[model samples]
Target: MRRIAGVFLAVASVLGAQPRKPIQDVRIDILSTMLTGNAGLGEWGFAAVVEADGRRILFDTGARPETVLRNAEELRIDLSGITDVILSHNHGDHTGGLLTLRRELGRRKQSAISKAYVGAGAFWQRSETSVLAAAKNAYESGGGTFTEVASAREIFPGAWLTGPVKRVHAEKNYGGTGKVRNAEGLWVEDNLPEDMSLVLETTKGLVVVAGCGHAGIVNILEQARREISKAPVHAAIGGWHLFAATDEHLDWTASKLKEFGVENFLGAHCTGIEAVYRIRQRAGLTRRTCATGAVGGGFTLKDGLRPGTLAK
Candidate 1:
């Protein structure tokens, strides 16, 4: 009996010591952005279909449902397969495609999106009833539900939502010109508390996906490190919201990102082309470090070219 107990303990220890298997590959199909390699479908928004671990996830919905759907058809991406939807923020540009996505699901008579993961502040619109009303309406229309993330939580085995990143660093740049409602129902300047990021733990490191990135880029990365995972950030794709950044702000951001040792970076949507150029030129970032994010561009991180290399 003593020997058997010892053997069971050994087996338990071995099983506990084994690390979880990392995700094999992540395929990002960009549906909308500022520019397009495919003709006629371009919008000033961001949305991507992420395929990994046998799950099809929609990162954002772009600025317009029509544009996103059109691009999805052109890319031959079956919207009926998306099981999860992660909304980075509550802006119309990011949530625009919910209605259209709902419509598509209704037409197919199939359940594509099961749940939409959103931040706490997602439903808090300045003066409006609720910015998330659109999302709620769509979900109800399709027999879906909304999962509000107040803190860091993992929706999947290795996928996490860096729930509400804290702005610990310098606040030189005033996020964006958006607002949220107060508890008393008054509109106040939005600090974008609902801004969250998606972190995918992989063999190499963490692959972070941001929408708008209203919570400074550095803050988002730091939150990922502090709250979610300790692994180094291997690659980051999405908007940084540096459209109105000054030369100094841009330089500082680039230098900080370099310090963080981020190997791959792809900025788009609100990251302003001029901001990208400045980061590459003055901030000492290489073209490879400062990747392209044209519309309708699909980026396959593993089993293909690195992030931002699939620019058309």
Candidate 2:
């Protein structure tokens, strides 16, 4: 009888150790612009904040923590209240602000928020091998915890960091250059990895917060559907990496997205102005342009969609 009781207790403990399902209320802050003052294109990055069952989770610190912090302050966002921080990839624009952010939180006397660095290990390789390596090292040295993502994991109830997206589509190469330094000094290239996105299950549908969509937007959407099993996509916001895409690629992507019935899209960063115009021309989809000063601009599952106010 005692053995039976012990066995039952052990089973209960095992079950208790399993992670609970995430609750869901997701919001993303477009902390900065990929295009700077001169309009030179840059890497895509944003800050994703999710409030699920009262817990606050931050995703992807932008290129400048100061910029993100300033926006947070203006929006009345309390960094001290954040519970978790998730970095989508290792690019400087995506993770440049983590150390500063940690310092800021420390200054406020708040315990360091738990952080999850989700991406392929490749992100930490050298720039000659991987363009995002430097930023990955910087983020790690800044007191952020790293979690290797193999499959979807719940960071909060109903909020998941979809693991590294698998490349399954034959999209155009859209060759472009990325800044890198080596024995020969700074250079550029067409090699970059397609990574994960933040997926939030809302009352209306799934809201996908992407980083760069290097994985192909269609692939990301299909994976999101696979993860949630037919959860209609309420909205998708983030860099779409469509700056150099051909007309056919853009058209095909738009067509595929329409078939999935995504309600809203807020494309920024690498999603070129041309792509934005084209997307807007498509019917039944609400589109918005996001940039640096628009940090506080975001959408809620309940609030529907809101664009950043145009700067004068």
TM-score of each: 0.87, 0.77
- How large is the C-alpha RMSD of every model relative to the true structure? 3.3, 6.0
Q: Tally clashes: model 1.
A: 1
* lDDT string, candidate 2, 145-210, tens digits: 667776777765677777877678966333445543322443434334426888887767778887
Off by over 4 Å in 1: 1-18, 128-131, 170-178, 182-187, 281-285, 303-312
Rate residue 84 of model 2 by lDDT.
69
lDDT values, one for every candidate: 0.75, 0.64
Best by lDDT: 1
- Over 23-58, each residue of candidate 1 has an lDDT whose tens digit, in order, gives 777877777778667443768888888776777789
Question: Which structure among the candidates has the greatest TM-score?
Answer: 1
Give, for candidate 2, the lowest lDDT window spanning 10 residues: 35-44
